[model samples]
Target chain A: MPATQEINIQKLGLIAGGGNLPAYLLSICKDKGIEPFIVGFDGQTDSELMDGHCHQWAEFGAVGKIISFFKSNDVTDLVMIGGVKRPPLTQIKPDLKAVKILSRLGLRALGDNDLLSVLKEELEGEGFTLHGIQDFCDRLLVQEGALGRFQPEADDWIDIELGLKVSQEIGSLDIGQSVIVQNGMIVGVEAVEGTDALIDRCSALQQNGRGGILIKTRKPQQDKALDMPTIGVQTIVNAHKAGLAGIVLHANNVIVADIKTVAKYADKYKLFVIGAPIDKKSKSVTERTPKA
Target chain B: MPATQEINIQKLGLIAGGGNLPAYLLSICKDKGIEPFIVGFDGQTDSELMDGHCHQWAEFGAVGKIISFFKSNDVTDLVMIGGVKRPPLTQIKPDLKAVKILSRLGLRALGDNDLLSVLKEELEGEGFTLHGIQDFCDRLLVQEGALGRFQPEADDWIDIELGLKVSQEIGSLDIGQSVIVQNGMIVGVEAVEGTDALIDRCSALQQNGRGGILIKTRKPQQDKALDMPTIGVQTIVNAHKAGLAGIVLHANNVIVADIKTVAKYADKYKLFVIGAPIDKKSKSVTERTPKA
Candidate 1:
């Protein structure tokens, strides 16, 4: 057998969301002979990502500590992986420095997007380069064409097109990803409750019929490094229960955590899975603009 | 004392959403000496509405029967009241006639709007006139002006303007009525979750010291009689908990379920309550263009 190619790998900073992506990314980094330092938010960062891959760590509400850890360890670049629950307020205990920064942000600035933006700016100001997770984890990026059994009928494509466009606009608002569309109409959109609950809501709307399509994608003006969109086999399972016809994600921008498993499940459900690249010209205005 | 002009009320119908609106409308209907008939949804109609005010009624699963209930009771006109939860599927024991209607609607026809739109068409097809909840209870309509001690500042008005326009656009989609905004940014939106849950989610988003605002209004194309927006004292209480600045509802289209009690709570929280009449000129697309 031919020897595996050896490549130069640089150290990486990992801001993990609660999922297997971080662990998988770390394993890839290790195989590439790269070191990864981890920082996680409470209730969001998967603990499994810390399985002998990280060099430094810190918790949520300890933004300053995270910065300090990254600095002390000399980690200058990072990747934010997967998705997370909206921060739980019950367990948060902000340190002094974190409190001062937080206090200056007016009530409106305290929203999740604004808060995350603030953190991003602070880290950037400190001389660390934050690259989109997809920048390094090329293996996790989505590919084009149908990976599942169902390639979608003509009608399903119409709804899929509509759902994909609407979800991206919703993302631009920083509301959430994952919208349920059926017969060219959006039935439900995921907000604070996330995708699972949104699917449940969509299922309730359908009496017993199945024609809806589930769409997930990147935000229009998305900051990818801080929020890498993701999907899994479970998403396929949820789509099946909701009577969904197809599933769509942004090619390259979206992460498929366990592509093999997800692909198999999609095959079993006859659900189409496609990684659609953003058309540069159409990025400004989505194709399926909702009727006014 | 000027003799109070008693409403020479006839052909009046009371539309109510859950909570206290139905009972309140019923009492008002009784005082006026009108035998108020109701067209209420099952699982949503207060048991009280069925027992006291309605001379004719039928559950949602039986729209075919409802048309006859109104006509047989000599109810020449009708109104819709009280919001219904999405009907639970497990309880869908549709009568044969309802099954016929259900067959007419495809998978895309989900939620109350789709079903109600079809019902309205079918009812008109049968010569029954549908009406809004505020038709008889004119006193429940919000007056144009600030209704409490607190008044909106410049920034609050800016947000109000932004929200008002966005809410209308969202309304056109038939997506929802309430939107949570902060510092000219939308934080959370009401999509099937209703008002209270919208506020709860917006509150959870408070991370940088930014509280938010909640805006509720009627959809531009919404048939006035079937659904006029509403809020009450409890709305103010929820606003206070959610760390909101004010509440904005359409001056004419919305009902403050209890004005005096709601005003009292607004005073306590120093929450501004603005009731702007739907812009009279904004009926067409040109006028509907959102103000800069």
Candidate 2:
């Protein structure tokens, strides 16, 4: 988004999880002179970050309390930020309203994406505008070019394309949004285990120090407002630890938490960070950002 | 496959690698009064087992010497048995003929499957009848049903089906032939690291003791006579170690080495061994062996 774009929203609701993304979003809201009301999760949200910001804490599966907190604050616009560790259903102490929601969506077979989508729909049904974090913080999205000093080599580009293709299939299945490829073979596919663990596992299995490329993209059917693929300095650091050659992400489709720090880390590690262009014609193949 | 069938071929060639499969094949040949000529890779083949047998040792990629050794032994039919750790190209001391073959097929970009297929074609060109191990030892193929005392529960069946679907897609891309799915989510997909490693990774990521199902099948375009998916006692032991609920193999398409021991292991571990039937219309989805 252009810097000159005028903001119209007055009150924004932030559903915060773990990571610096939530704090960054809050800071952005403050800079734009918008009132931010935060609904933090019990074990996920960073407590210190939300100290002075009007916020309420709820258990991971306390859907009823989360919805009520937003409604009581008269917040009409909401964006879920950061990541939540998927809590076990048995541990979730659901209220009557949460029970109703859980009953409607059978808990036995729902994957993370499916459950998030259900919650997003439920929140939207309550007369609130569900906003993708990008709406308020588009600067976080990386541009379409190399972010660091290094550019992908010819072979690295081939691996990047292969990773993209495999990641699309992975996303289509709602498995996960990252794949590591090297020497024209898929080294790893992200599943329930997140990207860091995936890269760590790949590193253990990688032959020698011959590095692979890591690709992170949005799931084909993912709810943009709920969870978009987010990468930051830690991703670059982890990729380096994993002995990966580079990292490729879809431009305008992924949130690069802090591009400057991320680029600095990439340069320090001699790793290329390329923002792959999303094919607009095939929206499903490469996830699209929410339309303003 | 039936014991009543009389053997006509006098000499059988075995390209041995690490595992009980090659030894099992040789023993079968011995019982059937057929001469077993072994071409063993130095590092991979079980040295002690082939000690007294008529065998010749060659480096992993000594393609020329392997073919020549088979020819000198008057072995017209050949079966590549068990797994060989992929040797680095720099370590491969290819003879003049092997160099010629490698040069014709530029070695830089070929995957394991592609390279194996190329070798299979080259061997066939030399007038040797390449046989899937099943061709000579059909009794090793699992019959469709519950092979052990335990049957797959309903949820286990669901995970098995999910694994089959994912494994098919993985195979179609010529990545790997196995997938582990538990609680309706893919835990792991086999790649270059192979099945035992894949299961080990899945076991690490698996939540609780709720073991998933492991499905192994043939790649869509895989040359069956070259490198068919093989499972045996070790596979059962590893699956048991991985805390997997059961093992599912495409009936007839997979080689079940030492079936009695495998079944015994399955029963002891209370793990179901299922021979899932392949849909005739979709040959790539699940592999089916010839019914006895």
Candidate by candidate, in order, the iRMS in Å equals 6.2, 2.6
C-alpha RMSD between model 1 and the true structure: 7.3
Give one digit per residue, the lDDT tens place, for model 1 in B36-99.
7776655566666667555544555666566666777776666666676555444666676667
TM-score of chain B of 1: 0.84
Q: Compose the digit string of candidate 2's lDDT tens values, residues A155-234.
A: 46656766887788788877789988877678888877789888888887665545888998887788777889999898
Per-residue lDDT tens digits of candidate 1, residues A1-292?
Answer: 1222333448888877777777777778877778888877755676666766654445667877888888888888866666654443445677766676668774544446666677777789889877765665556667765666667665556666666666776776667777887644567777556777777667765434555777788777667667767788788898888777778787666778788899899988878888765566655223432221
Chain A vs native chain A, TM-score per candidate? 0.84, 0.91
Q: What shift in Å separates residue B29 of candidate 1 from its native position after superposition?
A: 2.7
True contacts kept of each: 0.09, 0.40
Model 2 over residues B176-225: C-alpha lDDT tens digits? 88988877778887877789888887887776646888999877788878
lDDT for model 2 comes to 0.79
Clashing pairs in 2: B251-B289, B252-B289, B253-B289
